[model samples]
Target: MSEADVTVIGAGVVGLAVAAALAARGRKVYILEKNEGIGRETSSRNSQVIHAGLYYPPGSLKARTCVEGNRLLYQLCARYGVPHRRLGKLVAATEAGEEPRLEALASNASASGVAGLRFLTSREVAVLEPRVRARLGLLVPDTGIVDVHRLMELYLWLARERGAELVCRTEAVGLEFTGAGYLVWVRDREGTYAFRSRVVVNSAGLRADRVAAMAGLDVDRLGYRLHYCKGHYFSVCPAKSRLVSRLVYPVPHPQGTGLGIHVTLDLGGRMRLGPDTLYVSEPEYGVGEERRHLFWEGARRFLPDLEPEDLSPEMAGIRPKLQGPGQPPRDFVIRHEADRGLPGFVNLIGIESPGLTASPAIARLVAGMLG
Candidate 1:
């Protein structure tokens, strides 16, 4: 109804973090979310792991932000009383030839300032996880899990407390750049309304490219590819819970799809496996029960004792991948005025895996871009 100094176009984890950062900096921030609640998309459907900056290429934004944000996020969690724990992780090499690749991953992680990565021999891994038959492993003590929904709620609460407004179920349909500022047209149950804002941030996770097109920008011309890769998860039975104590991953594919149907434990101590990358022509979020067989097959690679009946359909998430499966992974595309020549506009595209982990750092970067 009123003009805002800044209008963030999405209320996911990254968007809420950006809004909170801006509000904390004394800006009148307004968050427009298309869903009824924040983080109901990729943010809420993720593995909820606090990555230790592993797997990303050296010197990339994903590597840098994830490494720094890992620390910042833990600090924020502690300060805000958000539920989280440093459960640690292991990049196991069950295959004989995969041992060197695991070592290389450890090297890359160390270069990224991820401390406490110990190279574990077969015997060491045995002591840590007796059931897992890993030839060698890299133990990452900093990786952990968090309550993502609670974190987003905390961000929204802090932002609201600082005079930020959250308009839920409001979808931005069109954008026009006026002489002074941009005009955003939003529609909902109440119909369409026009709002004005000097700065507009496009943090729309899946539809970021569409939002950019709505703003009269070419999606492909931005020199970034927005590929949607769907990942499915299956929950492990409670009886098999004792088989895994920490997160266990296989050597990541150089393509950065985060291969190896690894195991992840949630805050409630529930274990789930999967997130196998599958590229689709269109972005789809629905995970059905028919995929349980595929999940069980993938899970048996590292977890040999897993039974086909032990898995149940859990959830699915899509990553805004910048590169395809076989191609090399690209750095996060955070385009602002410096690159796009669009003043008071910021675009966050292709934010995948570590995006959740690097959310706070991404918010700070967005703030810096605004300034």
Candidate 2:
């Protein structure tokens, strides 16, 4: 097989974005995906909300990339005519006890370079969302949703236009460092094959840790092990879809298991609630039918008008986590292992949440690292 200057594994949004960035720099980039198509997993099955750099710890990659990526994403969308909306978001504090978390989020957001956040009184929230009952609200003018498929399509198109080759259903099964470069052993419908590249980017999302291990990195020993945290979403019944115009969030779990069951509106104005976190033994994407009542109870905090039957199973996605239950939040691990005596190999693990928003920025950062 012909050698590539740079090869990226995993054709999810981050990998595709990384390819786009590398290709733009005139690198001979190639992408391989295990799935038959891009975004078959966590990329497409997500909240699809453009986070406003609000919930991450200060100085973390998630914070920095999300802040910058959010800005860059809007520009890319506009440039490529990608379908999206900066329709804004409202994170509400429905109970008095939750108001402290609101203050902390505002402070953290400001520290993370998020601008134009304004606290709202109950009356103001009532004016904006008549059905929402909250004692206080935080309006983030920058949060929005995009047609993610279109966004990925643009990235793939841009990469291809720049001479990057993307082959779906190609799985990288082995990685070994050599004098010439890194050898990537891959398999596809045709058969197993191998190629060499000066740089290898492991953006394999849920399987990122395994990819790292293929390069001789001791993931568990290095604390780079990935925990699969599953989150479920339930779309609101059409009768109640008009109940929200903005993304309405309850106070996030204090431990950051996942964002609480909150309301999100698609660009089409349909509402969905979801994403309670459950640590699973495997990478299961099945929505728990038994958890619908829990969704109703949690979302009913601010969405008081929701009936028990107002929600139904929508979808589920798994997060590749570095932090497990009750652990302090973990930052994304994106490092070129030069210090490990292996240069030009980058590992990205636990890139959940703001990953979609931060994808472009991440690509640029990778390009800069290679530079």
Candidate 3:
């Protein structure tokens, strides 16, 4: 069996960040990725927005990490030449009566310690985004976009530089917790084997709950069972895409299932709208052309000029959510599992949206947990 000081299951952004953090702390690390490459799943499939810690409750992991990670990620991107933009974002109150909701969102963000938030009047918003129609706007300067591919690559490179090993196309099928450490049972094209480690971090994005179950945890009983929430994105035609230079969003969903179909620009400034929430039994990435109207209708509230034909099915991503449909928002579950008789097994579950934004902070948090 191969041996390492730490084994991180899954190679999504969070896993890579955790591996990098632990390795940087002088812990020998091994990253096992089931896919052919890192971040093939939700890591590479979403809007890639660096969230501003606006929506999560104050003092929650989502808020704390997002705010901290926002700063860290900006520093990393600038230092490493990662493709990114601090183009900012606009949370709009498109209708007259919606200004109260916009104010509430700002208040929540303020309580979460989000800085550089400014309220803009309709005239001010129009001055900044002529194409948008909103009664009021919250200009969040910390909100931006990043090239997730480049960010993940940087994390992997950092980990490898610190003497970490990445084994791709390998899946951790089962985990056996030894008295002192863990024996990670894994499989590849060849066969199955075990990798012994002093510490194991289950960072499996979509299958985190399953990985926890493998470690003999009662996932369902503990509320670690994940509900797959699929969201679809539609790219705006180039002609219409240039209408906005910043990310534009409507008041978020009342239940917090999604941020509402709004506008997000890539690093290259190509606009896309999407990610309406739909709970699914499995992770599926098929985008229906028929849903183009939904995107147009949703964004048309603020983007008055938008038409259905401007949208084209882009991609779909699934969030490993802790909350099912109509359920209240759930905070991220990051625990060492020592209380449950597994000393060094850290489980990161329900790490959906803001996860990418919170990765670096999550890494630091995990490293501290292990240490």
Candidate 4:
């Protein structure tokens, strides 16, 4: 890699989406992935849910991108023959105290222009999911799941077809800014190499801040701080997996990331209980069987029939957050930072939940920023 037009710094869904969009515009885009393959990090480790844009606050980047992404993703899947299912989700309230939260959620969804969200009584919940023992529920019909790997492949294929180059096993280690462009220092199996690009987009997911720092940007003052949050998942046994169809979620934790220990189904109809958030200092993805008891308590509220042994260790994924523990939830940080004295250097930080869903929209936003 000697000279390039635009270089994207990550190969996660958002990075791939950005590369594909720029390539489609005939930008001579190059995707720089540190890993041996694409989507191996945050992209592959998620619940793969196509979010309904209901959880995010109105007027935030996450809200706009997710609602728009939800529509665009469905269309992209249909157009590209990507595997997905709009199974819809049941946001359940197990107690009388949690009922108001249901009302608030529906109201909030309406505010975000997310249509087809309606309240579900206990009877309605029983009709939809007989095993769920919730007193009240909110049915978000647009919520769904996707084959994340297929989605990434589709993005990469489209990008490659449009003349984007994906160089795996090459990690961006340093950045040198020229008057017009950037010098990206990267290392691969062979040795260290450098590429010059007129434009550099840092869509590096968890390590986005580090990428920003390499460009001589002050991350702290730039508000590019990132904290790692880990979420563990458990797979339900086959017998119990068949019993659930729609995704079921408990009422959100007030000061938490929302969507507490919830149940998500894959395209194969396998049930997975997960993604309970725990702040960690590093990126660790080992699922602990010891969490089964805690998982049982949280899941058994809605899934009354789930037994202790029904849950098995599955996997874990970490979120790179701009907001730390006990802090107010922050919106997605898509900074052009020309004001920070770095033009053509965009930093996408704290892109967690809905990042997968908002990949396409985020890509469009980044391309627009570059232009």
User: Best candidate, lDDT-wise?
Assistant: 3
Q: List, residue by residue over 150-261, the lDDT tens digit for candidate 3.
A: 9999999999999999999999999998897989999999999887899999999999999999999999999999999999999999999889889999998576689999
- Give the alpha carbon lDDT tens digit for every residue of 152-266 in model 4: 9999999999989999999999989888788899999999978899888998999999998999988898678899999999999998997778999999867667578999999
Model 2 TM-score is 0.98
Candidate 1 on 1-371: residue-level lDDT in tens? Answer: 69999999999999999999999999999999999988989998889999999777778899999998899999999999999999999888878778778888888888888998898888998898888778888899999999999999999998999999999999999888886778999999999989899889999998888888888887777655588899989999999966888998888765556666889999889999988888887867777888888877766767788898898888889988878767776888887843455689888888888998999999999998888
Q: How displaced is residue 323 in candidate 2, in Å?
A: 0.8
Query: How do all the candidates rank in terms of lDDT, highest first?
Result: 3, 2, 4, 1
Residues 1-371 of candidate 2 have per-residue lDDT tens digits of 59999999999999999999999999999999998899898998888999999998879899999999999999999998998999899999988789999999999999999999999999999999999989999999999999999999999999999999998889999988996689899999999989899999999999999999999989889999988899899988898999888899987868668888888888888888878899998987788679989999998889899987888898898988899877887899989898997799998889999999999999999989889
Ten-residue stretch with the least lDDT total in model 1? 333-342
lDDT of 2: 0.91
**Candidate 1 residue-pair clash tally:** 0
TM-score of each: 0.96, 0.98, 0.99, 0.98
Deviating ranges (above 4 Å) for candidate 4: none
Off by over 4 Å in 2: none
lDDT of each: 0.87, 0.91, 0.93, 0.90
As for candidate 1, its clashing pairs are: none
